[model samples]
Target: RVSMACCLNMCGAVHCSDIAILGYHRKPPMLDHEYMDKMCEIPLAIAACPTAAIKPAKITLPDGKEVKSVSVNEPRCM
Candidate 1:
């Protein structure tokens, strides 16, 4: 028989045990471009990513508002 626990305490059992269950919650951040310019600091967000998934990008809206945005590489995001 095998026993497992949720990884809330960062215990090392997951690595050495014969069968251990490890789970983590990972949800990529949603980008709200309409309010992004006023609310977020692009450079800080990019730097905060541990996996280097956030990237700087630009978009031109139909209303002709040129806004600075970010692109997230979902595959690399964790």
Candidate 2:
């Protein structure tokens, strides 16, 4: 069984389906983008999202490459 700490700490890898068993937001919030690459795992989050509100967004990376990232529709989430 994956712990919520694992999910929150590695949320970039955990998703909606995983949430069904793993729980949500296990750890305290992190404002840093150090592991942004883990955002690639958002599809799992989307799958786990009961509200179906999670969506994808195009983000311009620091290196000037455009890529997809998980974005919550609300301004607070952005």
Candidate 3:
């Protein structure tokens, strides 16, 4: 059997096994367009992802406000 932990603080057998189980926090990225454009750097966020699951995107609200945003590819996300 194989066993592991998501973090070193959580487990000690990460390096001692042939098959180590790595855990992922599976959750979609929460986007706040208004705040994102004002406070965050979109490209930096996308590049920071190890899985490359984030991509640049645009959103059009019902009120016709076009907001620049980032999209998270859920299937590729880990």
Candidate 4:
């Protein structure tokens, strides 16, 4: 999971394979998953972001495999 935050003092993007999603601003539940390879449901995850900070990306992994994932575009307020 990922979170989009806006702060004038901080820059850069952070990605995490596992995360906790809060419900109704309540306690968040932990989510664990395996490798995030191509064909992952990235658009679905990005769609969940209220800030619209994420977008689908074509990235080459260390293993030389290209995959579709999400990347955060910082410095822009969505």
Candidate 5:
């Protein structure tokens, strides 16, 4: 018997199949600075990253308040 799985979710009969393939997330997550500053907790959000991809970003708002921005490490993303 032959079975296949597309993205490592293993929706197919992988074990029953003679061959198996596992996939993972190649692309990293998207980060919205506006969303983060207003609604998300910066430190907690960074810590939640499994791969530590999210780094601390800082930006200066027009009002002189600190605005956080990027927070993504591409090499560390996956």
Candidate 6:
């Protein structure tokens, strides 16, 4: 059986393969806006990103009020 892992954790058993074609980023992080708000401080995430890919943003909810959030520059994310 072939196994692959995105990172060094090697949980998928890539170490077992002499010629493992390990996959990369096949599963991106879940960054849903609702969860982001609850999970982290947006300002800190923005500041910590060295590439300045994250910026302040205002998102309008279903109720039509704007809320503070972060915006990402996809190209700079690399």
Best by TM-score: 1
Put down candidate 3 lDDT per residue, 1-78, tens digits, no spaces.
477764333343667777887775657656777667778788877766767777998988678999888888888776
lDDT of 1 by residue, 28-71 (tens): 65778877768978897677666778798897877998899888
Q: Is candidate 2 or candidate 3 better by lDDT?
A: 3
TM-score of each: 0.61, 0.45, 0.60, 0.45, 0.49, 0.55
Taken over the whole model, the C-alpha lDDT of each candidate is 0.70, 0.50, 0.71, 0.48, 0.66, 0.65
TM-score of 4: 0.45
> Given candidate 6, what's the lDDT at residue 69?
76
Q: Give a tens-digit lDDT track for model 6, residues 1-78.
A: 666654444545688876565555434344566556777788877766656767888887777867777887767663
After superposing all C-alphas onto the true structure, candidate 6 shows an RMSD in angstroms of: 7.2
Residue 10 in model 1: lDDT: 28
Q: Sum up the clashes in candidate 4.
A: 0
State each candidate's clash count.
Answer: 0, 6, 0, 0, 1, 0
The candidate maximizing lDDT is: 3
Ranking by lDDT: 3, 1, 5, 6, 2, 4
Worst 10 residues of 2 by lDDT: 1-10
Output the better candidate (3/5) by TM-score. 3
List candidate 5 segments past 4 Å from native: 1-26, 61-65
Candidate order by decreasing TM-score? 1, 3, 6, 5, 2, 4
TM-score of model number 5: 0.49
Q: Clash pairs of candidate 6?
A: none
For model 2, residues 1-78, the per-residue Cα lDDT tens digits are 332423433444444344534445533334223345565476775665545556666677687877666666543231
